[model samples]
Target: MIIKRYRVKSMNEAITRIKYELGREAVIISQRKVRKKGFLGFFSKKILEVTAAVNDPEEKNKYENSSTDSVENFKKVVNDKIRNQKRQSDFNYAQSVNLRSENNEALLKEVHQMKNMLDDMSKKSYDSLGKSKLELKLENMDINKKVIENIMNKVKEIQQDVEEKKKLKMVIGNMIKVEDKVLENAVVLVGPTGVGKTTTIAKIAGKMSLIEKKKVGLITIDTYRIGAVEQLRTYADIMNIPFKVVLNIKDMEKAIDSMKNCDIILIDTTGRSSKNKMQLSELRAFIDRINTKNIHLVISCTTKNRDIDTIVNGYKELNYNNVIITKLDETSTYGSILNIIDAAGKPVSFVTTGQNVPEDIEVMNSQKLTELVLGEDIIC
Candidate 1:
């Protein structure tokens, strides 16, 4: 039987390495407990050691015996090879321990260490004729462990970076403060399809009419959707506000002409997907017709960062003034916010938390945004 001793940082790493090197049939001979390190920032890590034994000797006899040997002779050859293997394995194990004791941590990262030691011991083994070659075996170990260590460190750094990203996502998500927002008496909510643009319009309209006591006029350029008119019509009806439905820029001009006397005109646009360039051009025409007092880009907080970039890029031709971050109540990943503000280069104006008419709207606060990013309690 052969015996070998291996040391590793953890018991799991050690056992996994042992199973990988020797087959599962290998038996452990002994184990030792490592002492703790002393003072001076020194505590020898609690290292564990295990000794394993394996069968050998059958291999040598197999080589010597004839091909037509009887069962008894074959059995003897198998046993001799097994014994020879066991003895060579033990000698290699002893040499590894002696070399390791000479202060060589170069082969100590668990798996690489075993491979290096095995490579040094394997090139000049006994010949197939059961005779020693006595050739040089330890001349060329071409492995550069330093490169491997560098790669391992880089992998660890990437893992830590991913962890930090996940933590930042949790810290700042769904937590923007909605203070009282100052309006220019007019605001345009622009975004891609299904981003709650019209509902956001109604939310702002309800707030303006009920809270600010402004005579809010609702304008819709959304004659495209089947119930787009009805949706705004329903919200305007609930708020007792006047509503206008315009199909094109000429119609928008007429609607503006009709509602020029109103205190605040909230324009509900067609929820065209940002990829539809033709519709975006049409909307650009409508926006250019009116004097931009408060051109706000309404965006969903739940959308991916790339999609937000696409939306921002598609809308940049219109030169919208500020941003409204909507659907904050639906998501918990806020990395998109940094991408939007930094990459899109747009300042945020308001935040919407829910579908409730007026109650869900909130004005943006910079300090509160910082606090949310830090996961700190909001200072009242």
Candidate 2:
């Protein structure tokens, strides 16, 4: 018999190669799991060591004539291969260790440089006795300085021996507000143009209809944007929910009446430029027909702090009750979330992390939001 061994990723791979090299009559003699021979033996990838053998008439005759000699020679050859593999592995391990040592030295140097830069910044920040290191950190996070002062002042009131990060989280949790209520009977989403109002509607509608099992209805008065109505309609169709298009106040009233049987109705209005008084007034007229108490002003997190103030103030006339912050994934700074809450005095109803429908939107959670704002972790 002729025998061979294979070190492969899986039994299937070994079997395929063995069959090709040792013929269809080949049979597995032994198999075991082994890691690559190296200093990082436990960390190395594990693979299958399969020994396969096949019947060979010529080899069988030679083996019978001098079976002992043949076996000894085979063992010698196997030992030689193993010894060479060990030598090669040792050489590779030495080279890897040397390279890693050099890399570690460079890494330590970079870390020292970073530490020096941070030390300089800390010294400069502390030049003002009014600001703590944590306060400076918050300012770097783009939180309004006034807001940071307010939060820090509040944090100083607590007398517990708590960690600074935890203290900040506690103070922020109490300071920021979020609306945790379920969707009202009639809800409307409005925002300035290009703030992802339509997509936010779909995300909310999807969660309500598919996840909450609510009899959800979708109505769009967003004819100003091309494909806006179709985009929402597609989401409605997929969810197998009722959908309608309203062109005027009369159309809006009729659409609401038709979906009166639905557990909740989600309305989508045309995005208006905050600068356009005429557009905002027109949107107000349409939503007035539904008389929704849950009108959420949608805004993008990527909006400049000043622009967010503009959008919020411009839409103030619409009497929106809550805020929906979208595109949280697109920006590095989260101060806008706290900024809007403080600026508008309206609790955030939801926050959208991406463009995905349903999956990317989260109903505002106070503790989680605080952690994210503090750079504890990326929720997305």
Candidate 3:
């Protein structure tokens, strides 16, 4: 084996050098962070030190040839032994053939009986295997007990030939629901802080204004957080839509009246801790004044199922009718999405997979949600 050490400014550079010089088969022996040379190391920069090894090609070739020769010799010996045994067996079988002819009827009957037994056993094993696989998939999904039971029962009602993934998709599609129409006038986005409410609002605003070519208006009641107003205002300016920040019911009413002629008005709300009843109540007061049918509860896909339950319940006063699950790309498991919607019994409106303003957002669909929950490979 040949070993070499590489020191570089970053791990990525070290890895690149190792791969380029040592080939893909090279193994990393050790790695560590080290400081560059400097006077007493006072102002030196940190760097990566990596030790890698690759087998010498000459030695590797020799070993491969030796193993290949041994395998060939073994195969030759086995084949000779088998040929000798076959000649002896054939001679012995010739002597027994006449005697076995008298018992052929009984032997055939026994063979038929054995084949029947094996067929029965195979059928039982196949059914057991399918059930076990289905159970394992459902167990890993972290679905609610009742939901799982319902799905299992539904699956039982399907044809046995249906694929497991198709059955799962059917069950999930029945459980997951999406809004029937695009969001319209006075859509208020509410959620806990750090849940991407502002970003979600911008995504929705951009989609309506840019894609649909609708006359969109942005109204933010998120004046509490520093830069909150500026963030939405910036997005509004980019989208070239009318924007307003209202502090009171009077101001909110005036903003709404000013943008009444617009196709749709997207409202951005200040995110508050769900535990803060006073803040929730204050938010509720503002939403009550809006008197709009479209109140979307924005929640992150990364949030814990328990915290999501609490957040949804806490924001009940807002009476959000729709849900927009954001940050789907950040989380691998989507059971929380099902858990949240199932617990809240609300339909999903839109889903955001990433931070890309309009491109990452999609109108929620039941089949897509099912694919996400069960994993993408399940369908493909």
Cα lDDT of all candidates, in order? 0.67, 0.85, 0.83
List, residue by residue over 1-380, the lDDT tens digit for candidate 3: 78999998777887889899999989899999888776966677777899999988987887678778878877888888888788778867875785587477678888889888767555333344444455556656766555667777888788868776677788788889998656677889999887888998888889888988899999999989999999999999999999998998778888998999998999999898888999999998899889998998999878876787789898887898988888888877787778778766889988888878878888867988888888763211
Q: Give the TM-score of candidate 3.
A: 0.62
Pairs in clash, predicted candidate 3: none
In candidate 1, how many Å is residue 50 off?
73
By lDDT, rank the candidates, best first.
Answer: 2, 3, 1
* Residues 36-154, model 1: lDDT tens digits: 55673255566778777665445435533543465667778888888898888888888877777653665356557777765654632545543222211101111122322332234
Q: Model 2, stretches more than 4 Å misplaced?
A: 1-131, 159-163
Worst 10 residues of 3 by lDDT: 123-132
- Runs with alpha carbons beyond 4 Å of true place in candidate 3: 1-133, 144-146, 156-164, 377-380
Q: Model 2: per-residue lDDT, tens digit, 1-380?
A: 78899999999999999999998889999999999887997799898999999879787677675676767777887788777887888778777887888888898899999899878667545645656678777876778776888888888888999876777899999877888868868899999877888888888888888888889999998888799889989999998999999888888888889999998988888888888899899888887888878899999878887887788899998999999988999877788788777767788988999988888988868988887788876645
Error of 1 at 68 (Å): 72
Q: Residue-pair clashes per candidate, as listed?
A: 18, 0, 0
Q: What is the lDDT of residue 90 in candidate 2?
A: 74
Error of 2 at 320 (Å): 1.3
